[model samples]
Target: MAAPLSPIVALVRAADPDRFLATLFAPAAQREALFALTGFNHELARAREAASNPMAALIRLQWWRDAVEEARDGRPPRRHEVAEPLHAAIRAGLLDAADLLAMADAREAETAEEGIPSAGAFTAYLRGTAGGWSVAAGRALGVRGEALALLQRLGAAYGLGGVLRGVGRLAARGRCLLPADALAGAGLSMEAVIADPRAAAPLMRAMAEEGAARLAEARAEARRMLPRSAIAAALPAVLAAGDLRRAGDPLVVPGPRGLAARASVIMAGLRGRV
Candidate 1:
């Protein structure tokens, strides 16, 4: 018999795509279970950036870590919701508890780190979190080797895109994720960019340039390993990058309303319409 979906996964499955596409798009059976995993991830992120007490956040993170261990040990967790997806994934050999623990550990580390340091350090943190996330996605998709490589590339690029989009929000919590030296090297400053997204026209443009470059790199790597049929799987990340570029294009004030319409046409073409 197929193992039951975890309550956490069920929570993730219940998320509306428009509300949380990041956690959706899995097979129906795994939907809720995946959702729960993602929900826990989101909770960690929110805890890092939210205004609640630091002590409270630390307590919650500890609770999550302990719960994961319990689930891994084959014991039914006290909080069934958190235990379910984790237990299911473990039984299926879909994920290693160590990977999940690494993620929780990283979140715990963040509560004390305060500010992001050098670009190297930031990238390490980014990769750990982003890689950890893709590991989960990899488990859900049951991919390995080359297919896994594509997913990893897609996840990393997509995660970076999310970080950029979430910069303003992250900053509100007094956290600065922008690699200050890297930005300065690019002749930019977070304060200036944040002060006036328009005033930092060059900076915004530079960001787009960097983002496009990263997307291109990801696309190239993905194309090498992703089969033609897998293009559909790859589309969302490309579409997301396109959205970012289009949003930064000054000429497209309302930002290319036609892009989606055109995308639909292209998708249809790719699917073999005359």
Candidate 2:
């Protein structure tokens, strides 16, 4: 029988993921758990957009939704391939199955939608997936109430940053995420902006700058309110998302320079030397 994937192995399968997680977390145990969580997230993300056929991708996403549900109810998973590692992370981190299910729900909704209409809808969609996921991770690390809220806020910032960065690739998928109203006000349409990649650059710069500012605020809050021990606990989650600001575009596969920078930042935090 083939060996189950170690956390590093699964995480390292994707460049950004490996760099981000490896740099931010170093406790062999926590790293393993995080690797499992991020690996599953990356899988779900790809299943939604990687394949040529949208119908097939939708089916695959549905299968994931079902697996999340089954795992939540303590039923043996229907899809072992994705379920096993995810289950391991849940156990290791005290992760709630509900948050994972919520992620699937967000993807299911996005897959069915024709396209994002405005920034509000995009924010709502991100809240369900990225925001939910970060809150869950914070909870796993034992953050509560206010701290949890802050984490969710940071996650939202990360999601918005990703959308801006990935505008080019996202437009290629027959979906556009820029707030149509916002773009209209800016005298742009999703099509026009994407068609002329340079046209989108200004908005992308604005979004990235805004996201970085929000993240900086969140990090400051964490440093103040969170216990020192837990600061390290929170560091990786924030830094992994923060690195996106420097990763060029979220949707385009990150290159070696971006990946290497991500790894360095995380490793510094992991060593308690950042």
Candidate 3:
């Protein structure tokens, strides 16, 4: 029988299936560490959803921030599924407390009442959250320098595509991930989009195009800079590109299509192109 998955791996597979699938491409020895990192990310990203209100969300985020600090100081992590594995990742030198803390801060920032202010702000947020996580993942995999930079770019592209693809779901909760500038450029407002999603199609299409551009840039850079071992760290690029292609449909979630997604990732891994 297959060995039972640890809590962190189970959490990752349940909460972020795409990433869980992507982790399958990683070197076997590193899979557990990668799951811990991504699972922690999933917990942070969903903190707000699990809370009853914004303040409650902040409290949850603070708990994670404190957990990271405590782990860094040699204290035992909180007795929780996510925290336990996260502490292990840190102790094993697969992750950095500072990076994880920064990610916590980014997750808190995402809980703002105001929607994204501009396209630039959206980009910054993606870089800080997704791009930052990519950096830590690369570090865990022993990637550095130029390869790390490429990973960040790929993360940003993947992040933006994810946000855009989830626009419909976010809209249901009165949340809008598209920046005000993009909305204005498309002649729509957050309120309008939330009330009627059809009004947001043009803007979503534009954001999709932007995500595609970033993916293209990251793909080109990865081909030139990333080493064979780091290819798994950049698998999100293929997933992001596929999502961008379907950005026009608000209800269409962006991810690799099951078997097709897995096949593409395998192909990319073999070719050393994320």
Q: Write down the lDDT of every candidate, Cα atoms only.
A: 0.55, 0.61, 0.81
Question: Residue by residue across 209-229, what tens digits does model 3's lDDT show?
Answer: 877986898788788877777
For model 1, residues 150-229, the per-residue Cα lDDT tens digits are 55555555555555555544444444456667667766566644554443345445665776777677767765665443
> Worst 10-residue stretch by lDDT in candidate 3?
248-257
Q: Output the lDDT of residue 181, model 1.
A: 71
The candidate, 2 or 3, that scores higher on TM-score is 3
Residue-level lDDT of model 2, residues 201-220, one tens digit each, is: 66666656766777778777
Clashing pairs in 3: none
Q: Model 2 lDDT vs. the true structure?
A: 0.61
- Which candidate gets the maximum TM-score versus the true structure? 3
What are the runs in model 1 whose C-alpha is more than 4 Å off? 1-25, 51-56, 108-114, 184-204, 227-236, 246-274
